[model samples]
Target chain A: MSLSISYDSSFDGFLSVVFETYRQRLDVGDIVPERPYDSDVTPSVDLFMQPFHVETNADSASRLRRAVVNMAGEDVLNLLETAFRSEERGVEMKILAYLRVLFSKSDPGFARNPTSSEMLPLFLLARAVRHEAGGMLGMVRFNKAPDGSYIAEIEPKYDILEMIVGHFRGRFPNGRWAIVDVKRCYGAFYDGRHTEILDLPDTDTLSRSIAEKAPPDEFTRMWKSYYDTMAIKERLNPRLLRRCLPVRYWKHLHERQQNLAGPASRPTA
Target chain B: MNLQEKLNILGDAAKYDVSCSSSGSSRGAPKGGLGSGCSAGICHTWSADGRCISLLKVLFSNACKYDCAYCINRRSNDIPRATFTPRELIDLTLEFYRRNYIEGLFLSSAVVGSPDATMEKLVYVAKELRTVHRFGGYIHLKAIPGASPRLLYEAGLYADRSSVNVEIPSDRQLQYLAPEKNYESIFRPMNFLAERKLEYSAGKRSRYTPKFLPAGQSTQMIVGASGESDLQILRLSAGFYHQQRMKRVYFSGYIPVNADKRLPALTTKPPLLREHRLYQADWLMRFYHFGHEEILDESNPNLDPDLDPKAMWALRHPEFFPIDLQTADYEMILRVPGIGVKSAQLIVSGRRFCKIRLEQLKKMGVVLKRAKYFIFNPDVPANLRRLYPEMLRPLLIARPKPAQLDFFSQLQAPSLPAPAQLSIAV
Candidate 1:
């Protein structure tokens, strides 16, 4: 009989599932995240495939981690972690299939091949997550609160709030800043010395309140001026602008709030 | 003028400088500092023209002494001009930076007084940002030609990248367009920065040795201004890349903002395709190990408007094609028309595990439409042996539609807007 395995939707929990599956010789019909893990836009769940819960084992997780590191290189292990963190539906099983492919091989060079069906899906998934995270690194615009703290709200496609925190932390080592993932309602708050991932109140309300508190500053006016004047009128390309930056990101990007399609292209309504 | 007016005027003037890349330096925030440079660079947004807006690109000033015919802020033109005090520039940068509106500052200036005086003001901002404010963000300072080597050295100390735009391709053309500028002034600062970067990185490091030009130097050249051929531009770009630590060589398609006897007709379209082709050739030279001579020679003085430079080169030398993907080296695979750097690297590593099938080749990011004719496998027809250059040329070349001339616009989707708000009846 085929078995369905479920874990607590953490990296450690996923690793624990990898260990438990190998030890029990579970014929994995499906592997799943316990807490309603939804993909980017759609809320999807298969009614036929329900998973029985498996307790997360730290010892099991660590042993598998060491084995994967010893067997394939750290790069392979990193690829797996990045893939799992992609938070896409059916990702857990895709990662499992990839791990099966890796553990089946003796030579680490076999893991380098990305053309296989097992490996390619995981690579595409990891790249999607990393690509979104990279965009967030640039796209997050912090609005200074009246309290002298920086607060920014983002609604990323994936759960990448934790992924991009390192960049902001490094960029502003001495300033207090908070980046909140509005969709997930959690944030990484940096206090100049230490960073804490805190569950916050409804971010929509928080962001709206912050906007009311601090009006646009002089520098923001300066930035808007700089942004507007930078475009050469002769080469006005609204078509190219939409391609580089997808429109969904415009909802959160403060500068794109007004008629940012520019006066030339704004007559479409 | 107020700070707002200066920012708008100077920002508009500096828009044409190009080179807004904030990559290649991992300048982390120091203890008690405000920001760090992103190694891969974060483009905050793209401008209306589809250019990346990574830095707060603005001129420190636009009050010019030289009368360059191509420039908007030339001494000959009577545009409203403005210059920023060092304090004002610093304040503007820090505030915008803290709010994450920009990655860092890209400060270029029209020569305010002499080149040395202008360069000193630029250097003063960098030094103050690093030493006084403890700012650790990316700074790209335009090394004004004819600035003293000492000032350029100090500018290198604090800035991640220092670049000097050799505006015109050849010296004679430069003399015709920008008479006050010459080859010596442009090359002098470029040579100094390259040598200094080499000096800093060559030996064992002491604790006190500061990083000099961590991102190295870059240069820009205007295309189609003096009617220089693609051959001339590529050769000059190749020369700069060969001679110095040129991280990037930017190509600006000339927009005729001024009328001069030596310049092209005002009605002539800016040679956008030629500028783009030059960049593609530059990319091939840097990444694909393509020599400049291989790209352009005595016969073809221009890049083909229909086919890309790589495809053109492939058609010119048909002997290289029908490459056996299984046996060819990475460099040889890269030379194939459809395969890019990513696919080439993938092919080399992937063939180790299993034979790459036709289906798997598409999965590996190969553009099957373009790559099918070049690669040899069981799936690609054996009858292609009779395929000659002339027939293949029409098949491979994408005949340019007006929008298709820009590769980006070919894939561009119309902007998605949220449902429009209902206008209430008055």
Candidate 2:
């Protein structure tokens, strides 16, 4: 039979198709673009999936490959693989856009214009992901899964699992831990022996972690004391603080200062 | 005065000077040092409205003996005045730093007491933060005009970056607005520090080099407050960069904090757009190979609010348009209206690999809408160049008005990732 095509209609859908195309070695027809869409299907001829363009795929995928080269270089394909692991779709387009501009004027072409292009965009994106990951990285309040694996749940605007793993891998390379992007449901991990991606636990199950036993080390009380003393009452800019560290991220943040850990789990740590 | 009262008066009085920057530094903590410098870039976390707030910027004291008309902290004003002791200021900085609140300190002050005494107090803060506290964090101290050279040198040793304010755009304005200060008091120390920094870097004197402000010196002018035009500011900034060995010339749009008859009462807010344009032109001069005299002149003192400096320059010098990218010198590529330093470099480099097609240049992030009128690459169709002027006029005329987009975008993230991998997924 002729190759069968499925429409996933999301970033993961695009990634799933990409993965499937690589796996099946299929001569994929049309991939939907982020912009406008037009379709002309001729059943008699080879099947034509929806015709679309990726910002990267346009100009023979120059933007995409250039971005991959810029970000991951010889190993840029690895960044592409990690990017695909992201549950979101348009993110890849923006990622590719960001990468292409970054690579254009580095050493090979360091002509001038230090403040021009990619600098602003790259800064905005990296900081957005870094901010989310750093917040979760510092304040996740992990607990032991039945498998003895350390697990923490997070909901972030950007694909930050790779970012989180990068930091955690450095800090806890020997430990078994998994940070689940609870909203997207799929999570990545390093269990001391191997690294893999797996479906995350259901919300109901993660909620039960409160009643479950806690790790012996628990929360560091000194860290909480340090956080409380850091704010200068004289220089406190709650308006500025709220503006920088949005209230959305506050849900995942642990105010160990007040001995509060989980949401509605009360004033108890 | 007590620490709290001092902080209130000094911080409030110093807010309008507008020259505390944490850019172009890279020093890390020294051995036995408590802090490190990350000058390669400082984290300027801007507010939603786009005001950068990473430096613990404050004044040592605002009780100035000099009566500069443009200054709110002038001795003639009846505002509250206070001073920070070395110990109290150092304590505040350490406490704020441990909480991850600020990256460095931007300490400036009006000339309080004698110039020697004021400069000594400022030096003491930096000295304590460095020698006693072992703090290695970035420190930007302002060098007071007419201060003793020894005090200026002492301030330089403990501070990573320092500046002498050239408040007025020109000497004529200096006489008009700030009569107490003159070019000799300001330029003398600046010239000495510049020479000293050169001497230190050359390793001529090993023991007493004293770092001498490793990030280099910067000066600021109050744009629009004085009657100086944009051309005047651009020319001065260019001169400072080239001749003075100054790292940056920060442009502070004149905001009338106090109603003074000597200072021009702005019918509108200090010309922020003009300040923004001056900054863009400054970038071009520093990195884009544009000359000060070449960019502006007596004919046009201010930049066109409707068009960017590059575009306006292009319209002025239309004869320079349609430069063939393949044969154009690197400098000429930088002059093209739509092209920037980055794009110009790309055009030159990409030509090494293959003929640069219009399509290819677009992929390299060329804003063809403007560049098409100015650049003529061999790979581009001849018809594109022949009709360049006619087809390009609309694009130039239809240029989108400058917007608040850049400021808002910066606020969304605290730091930027490398350009190539900046995915929206960030």
Candidate 3:
């Protein structure tokens, strides 16, 4: 007798697929995959693959949603976010396997230790993503982008493009905005209507792109003037400033507007 | 001044202000805007001293026009000076934020021009950071004394927090030392800002209540820099706490960075231990339900420098000791010398389940050395009752000195000229 297996790409899809596997009880030796692949199904294995096509208006999606609630408790579903963020595919599978065991056991451990076994993989992934998100939180220099929306460019260490955008969305809830992760060739766009993640051309090579067709406003001048005027004379602590704000992030700040707009007064490097 | 030079001077000049406590502000990053507020920003580093360096705590420019005698950057001091454009400071803040270096900006300046002029500059920096940069990060701007109320109010709209350092602990001390700054100059704006914050909060408007320093206004009083008794200083602190609604009364033990004849020579290192004791007293008053009068009365206005106020109180009020653990109220337990806030809560919670024995208290994480002599119950072993006193003193005495006061350790023995004499600022 051959054992069969199936797969689903998303967590929700996977839950639905798993539910079908148990409910249909098609055969003792057959399996189905949520995502289709160009592989020959072994005659002995008896495997089947299906794309997780959520019928846009289908109430069946709610059944899949219910399966998610049953298999992984709402809390586990939340914890699985980190696993989904894991760039490593193996970790994601391990997380899924762990979730299966949890659902199968219906153990209190799923509820008791949410951040531990159930959520640790996702936490590790969120931790990595948070670094870039945090850096973007600190460094994304906002300038007036074309069409009056605010735009910032960042080079984050993780694929936290969505998290970064989400943080900014709260900070400037009213503004139309976009933050492109220079390294990952992706960005999140928040129009007044909705926020969407988008992939972009790998524009990392362009080092000195100007804001497209936007004039320097009065606030910029006042900001420059204010910066020029506020530092004290008797107590200069460059060492302290360097320690606090490393020079690495000075490239995009609006204070650099003067240096960027004018001819280079001195050698930066 | 050049940007680099300004960054150096202003940043150094601004190091002494200890008012920035980042824990209160929990706002995250904005849409299309960069940076979120973290309790632990780079400049926001909390030292063993427990001081938070969350902001670019720097002076706009340290060139002073007023001759405040206690000030190291007094107008007459022949010190190297530098100034930054607001743009540079904000750039530095953004860069630091990006690099996880600083939480926000803590911009103070010596009176370079008239008070209005100096305040206008501070206001401009805050305004630029908020409106131009759309920066929602924490900002603590210093409200220069004698600045117009309008400027002060405008400054609040842009910054999260603001303060005017009271300098000396008392008006008399202020008169003797910082003649250019007086109680009215400082308190007027403080009072106005307090009212404004109240008004804004009461209006039930936007969640962005435009906090006129949500961390609340804090004032630095130069400890050991003035002749005011600890009692006098604490009274002033208490008054500020009650009337001005000051969030913190920072005690900066004067370090005597400059020399002057009118100032008193130090008998010992600027009373750092004394300053530390005052901070402990402050903490007790704030958290331990200690009343200002209860900690210090007319007979002994100053707390004993050798022991923490709570310990000293316990040693003096011995009648309250050997409190019955099983019968004591949580508040009474908290008042015991050995019991801290956490221990008191534990005792309250744990006692509800069963009769608590002395050994069980230790297992449940009670501070037995201090609490042992103060608490008694049927479960306490007979040997434990006799042995507890020995345990108490050794534990209390062995407590690690507060790190900030360790600056006084150099004055260990009187034989070595009592360290360098320090001139009192007030």
The number of the candidate with the highest lDDT is 1
Worst 10 residues of 1 chain B by lDDT: B417-426
- In order, candidate lDDTs are 0.83, 0.63, 0.64
| Candidate numbers, best TM-score first, in rank order | 1, 2, 3
Model 3 Cα lDDT, one tens digit per residue, B5-68 = 5665665667666576554455665555655555433232322233434566788888888877
Residue B119: error of model 1 in Å?
1.5
lDDT of 3 by residue, A1-269 (tens): 33344444444454544455445643323323332221343233323432222213234546755655686567555545544543444444455556556657655545334233434455556555555455455566555644777666665544456665665566556667777665555677888668888866545342234344333444444444434333332334455555444455445544433464531123142
Distance (Å) between predicted and true CA of B100, model 2?
2.8
In candidate 1 the C-alpha lDDT for residue A226 amounts to: 76
The DockQ figures for the candidates are: 0.60, 0.04, 0.07
Model 1 lDDT tens row, A1-269: 56677778888998898888888887787877765324344435545655567889899899999998987778878888888877777898888887887788755666777777888878777888899999888898787777898888788887788889988888888788888777677789999889999976765576566566655665666676678788888777788899888887776676665543221122220
Score chain A of each prediction against the true chain A by TM-score and list the results.
Answer: 0.84, 0.52, 0.54
TM-score winner, 2 or 3:
2
Which regions of candidate 1 deviate over 4 angstroms? A1-7, A19-27, A34-51, A55-59, A104-109, A209-215, A259-269, B399-426
Model 1 clash pairs?
Answer: none
Total backbone collisions, model 2: 17
True contacts kept of each: 0.80, 0.00, 0.06
